[model samples]
Target: MSNKAAVLVAGSWGTALASVLADKDMEVALWTRNVVQQEEINTKHRNERFLPGVDLSPRLAATTDLEAAVRGAKAVVMVTPSSAAREVARALKPFWHEDMLVVHATKGFEIESMKRISTVIAEELGCDEGRIVVLSGPSHAEEVVNRCPTTVVVASQIAAQAELAQDLFMNPYFRVYTNRDMVGVELAGALKNIIALGAGMSDGLGYGDNAKAALLTRGLAEITRVGVEMGANPLTFAGLAGIGDLVVTATSRHSRNWRAGFMLGEGKPLETVLSQMGMVVEGIRTTKAAHAISEKYQVQMPIAAQLYHVLFEGLDPRTAVEALMGRDRKTEMEVMSLETWEQWHT
Candidate 1:
């Protein structure tokens, strides 16, 4: 296979992935919305705003014209922030062809539609499911650009598409796994960001490792519950997209979601924290959508509920924590148990 591909990216993650593709001898076109970013990549061979200090390969170039960026590309790897995924997808529609393979690296649910990035792509592009792929895992953009060993999963119902993406992007520092569980994979990736927000809040609250661990574990349980109810595979949550992503996102300083939660935990207003981060924190919005989804599905999502209150209700973070602590005790596995499942349906 020729090492030539195009990547649509607007942030550090995009730059990092572009750098990876270029390193693998792929002729990568890195698209950006900002003209200054395009100049930086073309002139300095560095992405000053995103992946600073890392030298990008000469094989990679940058552009802002959406049509020019995607023209004639066999594959399109979208790394725009989740909040902008739909808008970007809409903008790309007129340029998209049936043969183009689209891959998304964003990990968040659209708050307005409660749709995953892949779904947003499909709806916007009017494309078949086989043409879209999602790449996710325990990866930090900062680390990935630095050549840290990372593993990710690529999910698509069409094995050929997934395998094509895997072959195109995989390298020694980056390992790729494939799965057919698109819904489960997408849901696992999007929902984990919400849980990571809670985990970061726990740390900001000065909670111990046990608290963080408990939150992470139970957060996975609830995420799985919601996913299973929504027709996703239960086992996917136990795999990379689920547990793996949750752990990395909840703990990493490089995670914008975790950082946003940490700020909230420290008593900063959501608006203020957001202004300081100056980037889209998918978890904040995902918390809202996840809570709504849970309510719609009649699933218990205490973490998402607490997070929503902290973010939107103007409730004190400490008070939110107390409320969660005061909930009536029940078996942790009750939600996932078959007997309880039968009881719910009955």
Candidate 2:
């Protein structure tokens, strides 16, 4: 087994994780489709486009060739956007060895299939879904690259595999925890981006902290509701993958989803918002997938539904908030019945 690990993209987050491995004195290969980006990382040690002004580790390398990146690597981290995860995994299939640990940091679903990223990777790689680990939490790429104190969770159905990932990326500044709840972690990570968009929209609308707090609280409840319905542990929503991720993404200036929602809340069209942002706003696509998932699972996600309307159906942001406020009265625990509580406890 080699100490080499490959990150399957040179995006901000992927580059940051690659830096983490490099800081551990492990050989890290950052794979990118852009030849220019590859040259920039290899020569300048700076990815000016995605992560500017941070010096990457000297041990870090970049490549445009997928085979060179994956061959004989001990671990492969897939950090492609959720929409590209399937294509990237398919490209890795010929190079992927069974012994190599597979992990993904994507936090959105396939808009067309409503499939989680792990499902997409497993199907594409022809591997057991349990073998794939998910890395997620409150850490932002900008802060992470600067060696700021950050914590994240690596989850897999196979405990040993998750521990292997934990060992690979853990450092003094970057703490890694292991969990068995891959489904919960993945869902919480994906769903939180939706709430972040709402939070941004609230802020843009000039709504005070009270509204943002309400959105975070009610958002967690709805996310937990749908995740539990889909076989995730409800408690997982309270952990880093849940509230931790939600708070950071919703409030942080580094969040692309929040910025996109802010622009939309300022009355910019979706096309204009996307054009100005120049990044993949996962929440927009995830909102579409969540709308479909909510219908498929018969789960109620009022915030997501309203977000779907605002992002896709051209509903005004203020009108959407108004609609949320105007909804019929219900108890705070509307989604959790006594039977549900007993089932979770049992």
Show where candidate 2 strays beyond 4 Å: 337-339
Task: Note the Cα lDDT for every prediction shown.
Answer: 0.85, 0.93
How do the predictions measure up, each by TM-score?
Answer: 0.95, 0.98
Candidate 1 has its poorest 10 consecutive residues by lDDT at 335-344
Considering summed lDDT, which 10 consecutive residues are worst modelled in model 2?
Answer: 333-342
Model 1 misses residue 238 by how many Å? 1.1
Every model's Cα RMSD, please?
2.4, 0.9
Off by over 4 Å in 1: 1-3, 337-346
lDDT of 2: 0.93
**Candidate 1 to truth, TM:** 0.95
Among these predicted structures, which one has the highest lDDT?
2
